[model samples]
Target: MSDDEGAGRRPKKQRPFWQELPVLIVIAAVIAALMVNFIGRPYVIPSQSMEPTLHGCTGCTGDRIYVQKLSYYWSDPKPGDVVVFVGPPSWNDTYRSNRSSNTLVRGVQNFFSYFGLVPPDENDLVKRVIAVGGQTVECCDAQGRILVDGKPLDEPYVQKDYPWVAGQNAAYPRGRVFAPIKVPAGHLWVMGDNRNESRDSRAHTSDELHGTVPVDNVRGKAVFKIWPPGRMGPVRSHDPQSN
Candidate 1:
């Protein structure tokens, strides 16, 4: 056959944008999704429950962080890890845990809510960790502040406007918590950086005389925030930074 005749039988040239572009994009998105869903995630701050450190009232006052789920795979939840968990009890006297909610839905939300993908639950609460099991956390400072391991903590993240003042007012009128009472082998004592507003383990979980959270109750640690461009950053412990 002649050279021109053979050339005429060849296939037509493809476009600059190959038809496979869609498939490639889908694959890339899937891989990214896998990394986000199972490897790391972001936690959104819904309310002022975790104020100062994480202000969520003024609009986009939250963070977008790479939450390492694998951290808990080897070690237990530390005293400073801002964990995301299911509230076993009604945190506020005005509200209670909804009964109709499905565990499956709750679990899914917990996984993707940080990516602006979905919300874990309408009642989710985010608070700072005050102490782990058996750590005595008392509000004995004349200024209504807290101390750990006999050392006075310095927290710059708290609301300066409400700096734990006690000179004019009674200190810890709510009552002093004599901790280090052995928070069970599998429990932890968590609190919000904003001592006055947070209804942490000190208030609700202590009714049973056990000032700690059970290991089973902990869902996972909040490593970072992925929402509110301005309020995005690592979810660090207020104790260490100040101390």
Candidate 2:
């Protein structure tokens, strides 16, 4: 063929849609998986872990928080982050295995609860952050004072009626000072606003562990309640050290 004829001839075009179909589908699947894993996740409050701060209605109904999985990307778990984390060692009955069959079923129930498929359960306790790591969180003083880092923690989240007393227990005693731990490098000392009822770091990790929680265990901070229209509000970081 002459060079002029060759130049005039057009090259056959390669079909792209079919050739790229498999790769495109794989990419799409990966994106979907990432979204489900990180972007937005659904969780059910299965027990009275947090109270007052959040309440459950039934075997299915309760308050919901849209956890910002990426929120911590720019920051670390702060002192006042109302967080949803998997429980560690269980000394009291309040601890629930996040992976157990019961909780798994609860997750499924929560999926349908939004559509009125089931009643919301009050098992999940929605409480405020009382004390963070490194700070000294004491119950009550001689008169009545809850101190954090030698300064009193003005806890308005505690049950309005049941007032907080220092070392109320004879063993611990009222007005007793709870020593402060440096919070370690990656640990946290979490407490429920409902001090008396919450079996948090104060009880479980005390003595042996001194209520200090490892930072790695934290899942995400409770930023907002997305369920039940009545209790809608933003979850602020009460911890001053969450810096």
Candidate 3:
């Protein structure tokens, strides 16, 4: 057939945008998933545990943070690094689901969580690392300070300490008193800046691991606060031990 006859028989037809939209969406989703799983992910602070460092208040918009997963592959978590981790089994003993009870609503929330729109359904928590493997940690020297390796930590970040009510709990009558615990290797003892309000390692010392979280359970290091225009800044990672 002649060139003109052949061209006329094979007319170019552009596909409608509606037909291409799904392909584009699927591609975008795949890229987002890879980044969230391997590179880093966003997390919303769920409580006042890390107050002053990361804010989370009930009935209010919590600070959204960017957690870097790449760093831990080369370096283990250090003291004072704010981290997000899966709670130890004992930590979640009274945990309750936050997702809607409706099946369809829960399913929808799960789908958005993959893209970091909603928080994960698991019992994930955030706290500052106070002591690492092999360190002896305890609370309340005469001046009321946390000790690591027998050195009192000068923690200026702890602005609010929960007060000890007289006769509340005999074991912790001084509010932050705990017997010196030699942290097990490969675990971390973490706490919150809001000392009194936080339920941290000190609260779970009776557990099998003695309230220490395994390093493997840490998801990532919280590097920056990305939500709430007024609170956008790097999450503080002060090494209290250095002082």
Q: Give the root-mean-square deviation of each candidate in angstroms.
A: 5.7, 7.3, 3.5
What's the lDDT for candidate 1?
0.60
Best by lDDT: 3
lDDT of 2: 0.57
Local error of candidate 1 at residue 126 (angstroms): 2.1
Kindly report which residue stretches of model 2 are placed more than 4 angstroms away from their true locations once superposed: 1-29, 57-60, 90-133, 160-182, 239-243
Better of 1 and 2 by lDDT: 1
Q: Write the per-residue lDDT of candidate 2 for residues 1-243, one digit (tens) a residue.
A: 899999999999987998989999878767755654466444555445466776653475766676657876676676567776655545325533333268778787765444433543323233344555555565455645556666655545555224435456455532233544545555666766555555666565454556665555555667787777887887666554322
Candidate 1 residue-wise lDDT, 166-202, digit = tens: 4544443353334334456667666666665666666
Model 2, C-alpha of 89: deviation from truth (Å): 3.0
Give the alpha carbon lDDT tens digit for every residue of 91-195 in model 3: 998789879999999999999888766778888899999999999998756566789999999788988885545554465533378889999999999999988
Best by TM-score: 3
In model 1, the runs with Cα more than 4 Å from the true position are: 1-33, 58-66, 90-116, 149-151, 160-181, 209-211, 238-243
Query: What TM-score goes with each of the models?
Result: 0.64, 0.62, 0.86
